[model samples]
Target: MLTFEEKLTIIESFPELTRNDISLGRVNFHFEESVKDKKVVVYRLHPNGNGFVYAGEIENSDYVTDSKGMVNIRDFTEKELRDVIQQSIASLSESETVTETWINNEGQTLKLIETSGVWNIYAGDDLDATHATYHAAADYLYQEGFRLL
Candidate 1:
């Protein structure tokens, strides 16, 4: 389980969450201390590696969900998610690494890697779809500041 401070640190590190009044990836992250609260933080992400606003949440030590109804973190096991979140925050606060691998047109495997930043991957050969997925992943990662790796 992550403390409120840890969660807040992660949320604040995200530019999407911290800047701009009408940001697409903005999320309202807060905690109510008086009672045990389940906080929901909404953001955008591509469902099929395309572009979309996919809401998600990190709640009370045990439950995380995405807008696509995909439950990445659930029950009491969500502590691992929290840990990932913390790692992401720490990475962004300093520097982070990201790597991507995919097949190119020659039926040969290609790898596009980026360090101290984020990178996206696409499965198909459509350039437009691939570009969209890359942008979507960048936006999602910028907003959430976390990924499954």
Candidate 2:
């Protein structure tokens, strides 16, 4: 729970940032370096008085950490920081699907996927069979094409 002034100061420390880029929250943004580009950096603060740095397109995933697993924002280089952001954006752009595989007694592989926050049978696109939980979604798959597999 850093004070607003303290958080503002932290963001301002980056040569790329100005007073206008940050807002109080679990995360903040840095646009100084990317003023002429589409890329922007993000910082997620920790309760331990340090913060994690992310750049480029953002996603809901692990925070960028150093080689030694330090999440402190000051521990990363410009390239390292940008790499983390690029990796996350690439992974997210590659697929919105989260899938788990199961094998049947007959050795058939069944893949269950959740995409766009909805769960459905991946092979069938059974939109009407959507469910709120992985268990329910997989159950639907199991009942449909995987019952005897």
Local distance difference test, each candidate: 0.33, 0.47
Model 1 poorest 10 in a row by lDDT: 46-55
lDDT of 1 by residue, 38-76 (tens): 322323221221111112221232224344532432221
Candidate 2 residue lDDT tens string, 1-149? 45444644545544443333334545555444342343334455533445654432334435554653334554544444444443333333435554766556666655465643445443332123446687787677676556423
Error of 1 at 73 (Å): 6.5
TM per model? 0.26, 0.27
Model 1's alpha-carbon lDDT is 0.33
True-vs-predicted CA distance for residue 11, candidate 2, Å = 45
Instruction: Show pairs that collide, candidate 2.
Output: 16-32
